[model samples]
Target: MEPRCHSWTHWADEVVLMSDTTSRLLIEDARKALVRRLVSVCGQRDLIEAYVGWILGDKTKEFVDFEAAALASKLRISEPGRTYRDVAVLGFAEHLSPHLDTLYALRKGLDWMLGRRPFLPNREPDFEVDGIALLGMAVGILASGEWEKRKESEKWFIALLAETLRRSRFELWDRSLIYAAQLLITKESTAEREITPDLALALAAKGFISVKEDYERKALELIVNQPNYAEQQVDVVATRLAALNWLMRQVPTVLPNRAAPEDVINLLERVRDSLRRWCWEEKPRVRKAEAVPVKWEILNEYHVQDLLWVILAPIFPDLEDEENLPSLGHKHPRCDLGIPSLRLIIEVKFIYNGTSSEFSRIIEEVASDASLYLSNDSGYDKIIVFVWDNSRRIEQHGELRQGLKKLQGVREAIVVPRPGKMRA
Candidate 1:
């Protein structure tokens, strides 16, 4: 019996060893294949960069800049209002002598890959090369082509991302991929608008080219795991609050007279508008210092309240001097903004994502808080719910607006600044 047991154990160990060995062999095979593919592309690996450098004669300017400068020079040198044919002859790409055919092919491949085809100057290409050589060259050309088209607006997003990477502690590969994906998605959009993961996924659904998968996956991963950029700005917040407190104390008589409840509601709207504008700024303030700002994944309800109290309280007189009015009923309810004269309470909810479940949760919390504030009868008259949809998560907040309208004392359900439009 002992011998049989030992033999069975030995057999199991052998099986485990075989599995490990098989996995290692497979990994090695994949590594070898990747190496061979890379080797095949070695000859033309730097061709695009070299060609661009040669054409520009300066390493500082990007390919797009070179193209733009060349085109502008052609326009200057050409006869006034030349025909389309004459203009074509003066094109930047037309003047390039080295591998002109290859450059054209590169641009064509880029257009095809970027979903820019079926537009203008479309061409047919010979399927000449395979493996990494073709793909490697194609990738560089695509980047240059996309940049040429999107350089103006795309820089803001890139610079923003670069600044964020400099400020944060994200890994090297993670930051690089994140920056690349952001640049790609920004170029993909027709409006030249900011991008999110869901937008990237939607763009992918609309049929982007081969490399789209890599970028889409990276963008999605980034959205899911976007680092929490909101560091506690204790010193800054405290300083600002102290300044506000002092200013408020000095001008106690300047508090706006308590008017109808509608006035308070309007005040909340203004606050919401201010926050939305701040959120959409080219360099959204993630930290106290405005030097290196980032957008999204940072400001929370507390930050919103802090900002509101400081900004709104000064203008609106009826706003309570105290911060975070305590509710007598349940421990869960807290008033972020309170109006003593009108008995109005304003709650700000920051929208993070567009998921139905997330929206549902937000709705549930608002409803519960509304019930709590009204339940206490501690002079709280109306609850104005401000949903800060910075991410444009609440697309068509009609249903949400309607649902919030049904809640008791909920005067207005405002999705701040509405989506896509912000006051500059």
Candidate 2:
């Protein structure tokens, strides 16, 4: 049997991936704010996942270890299947521009080989590519020409596949293509042009293909004639087709005499809206209860948010100052770990909850084994629970204030357990 890939996760180290200190600080504050808002809205504080998931449309772990390992082995050798190393080397192919050409290069090879379309790879060694399924998805969106439905399906497929990749870890997951196949049917509607012939010609000069037919041809050519090498590959190609089919149904809008660019774009959006509408109508909504995720991953503090920046920032000046760091801001931007860094972190509780003790214990554990915790971040500096009593009840419950005071490291812990309570 081939050896397994590394068992560690990129998210395991909290601070390494961030671009800079500002990004780290912003993420920290965003994390807390997200938690706080979640608590107030859902009657519980730890609902950040649900909130963000809703926005990201419930993307879950998609890639499996077996899939990674299989792909990894194939990566070292010249082959059809994409490997984990291939994906990593792509350096975030979907989002980054440099990776776009690499992604296209992979697609070209797969497209040519399967279609017998005569593509040469320049025959370089160690030149693995992005997952074909993923590239198909991008093509569905970017190259989708006259088919609105296909365009929509492509979007759905991409989102689903991206989510799958995000969740794939070291453990062997069910490496199935069922979900991948379903992406095409979910939302494909149609492809319509947004630019006038004049503006379109300009965009074309700028490398944007504005004509619907041109896009359709490109999208189709990518998937057409590729023999079903594997069920996974086949499904991906089918999914791409589904997105294209949706695009075919869409009615292209024509530009009126001297139509403004914005107007043309708006007209184009109508086509996209039509695509989504058709997709929604196509799916048979499951009335059954959602199968509870038995193994729902609970992202620890460090995995979800950077914890290394917490302790070391206090000791080492100029620790987290970099250009690309995402700030701790989600709903509201707060905290800057630059120039003036945070000496201590604080958490405020609306109702007197048991979380204060939990926070204290976690912090103390980290502080006790500073080297161990610092080496591999174990989430959070120290948990300090502060109770804000909006309703008059602090005096009614005398023990609340006393409990906050006893939590070890709390500087000025308070329990305004009264109606007219206001203290910072």
Candidate 3:
């Protein structure tokens, strides 16, 4: 029996080792696939920089190569009139170079790009490319403190960037670059203001972009079907590489997990508090100098349910209202609000009077509802009861809540008083 026990322990250890080995092999295979794709699409300078950036972060040797290439290309341009497209090149070079010549070139390029200097008659701007070039130029100017001396130009540059971001139908690579640049600018701004809305919108936009598709799986599909990178456009190839680089950097990091049961309870409690505030603070009617004030009231449970739906729907994107439950014997019941993702059901209750019997009836009704709502087959595992006490029975709330919590499947019980001001 001791030998058998030892054999079982040895088998479990072997299984654990095999599992770890399999995970490592899968990760290594994925890394190799990404590297191969990067190698095949090394034609563009940005593509090369992206590949190097992924592998070495900021210490990549391609930065030196990129600087040399930029300087060489700038030297070949004989005519000052043709330097409009050099904005990105000069901007990047300015970031790298300490010399006065690179700064002069970036200024010239910015002038042409921003239309302070006239372009040659035939050079209609590709606004998408221009947007990307402007992003690079902004980085250079910010790095060099050029924006400190030219406040008006800085304003124009920011306006142009904003307009371009708003109007341009850029591909994924250009769009991502613009979004990332905007995020960085917002982060580094010194202005005293509320930046949460701006930051939230930017993050929401980034999340929307990243979650639109399984990019790694899509990249693998492209690799299998289109073996020849020569056939694809340079921009398309760069976009694919950029996406894979993003995937590689992001895949290892974990996002915040879904809302837990405790979090949902806390959120519902906040909602309950908000309802009380609304009841107490909201003016019942607008009084004219000579006219009588009109009356307003939360007349029924449906009104409370509707208000709760309005409050909770935005918080939980998949919140279902009036979701029907399967029949239990002769009675059919519907949950007021259901968050399927959290496996939570919220039932709204309204009391007409402050009578003890009415409060007792609420406890009984909630107890019965709990059994009907929660079952082995039902998807929902937790229930929250929100009671709006229109009769303003603040005294009975503790008893009501205690009674509700004693019932099976009831995770939270919130009892809010109707505003005493409404009695006037």
- Which candidate has the highest TM-score of all? 3
TM-score of each: 0.34, 0.19, 0.39
Residue-wise C-alpha lDDT for candidate 3, range 117-197, written one tens digit per residue: 322357664533453455455544543333334455566656655666555566544554555445434443321111122
Q: TM-score of model 1 relative to the true fold?
A: 0.34
- Structural RMSD, model 1: 24.8
Show where candidate 2 strays beyond 4 Å: 1-80, 85-345, 352-379, 395-412, 418-424
| Model 2 TM-score, all chains together | 0.19
Q: Candidates sorted by lDDT, descending order?
A: 3, 1, 2
lDDT of each model, Cα atoms only? 0.41, 0.29, 0.53
**Model 3 spans > 4 angstroms off:** 1-257, 272-296
Of candidates 2 and 1, the better by lDDT:
1
Scored by lDDT, model 3 comes in at 0.53
How displaced is residue 251 in candidate 3, in Å? 18
By lDDT, who's the top model here?
A: 3
* lDDT measured at residue 300 in model 3 versus the true structure, 0 to 100: 91
Please give the RMSD of candidate 2 to the true structure. 25.5
Residue-wise C-alpha lDDT for candidate 1, range 84-154, written one tens digit per residue: 22122222233232223233333333333333122133543211111112222222332233235334323
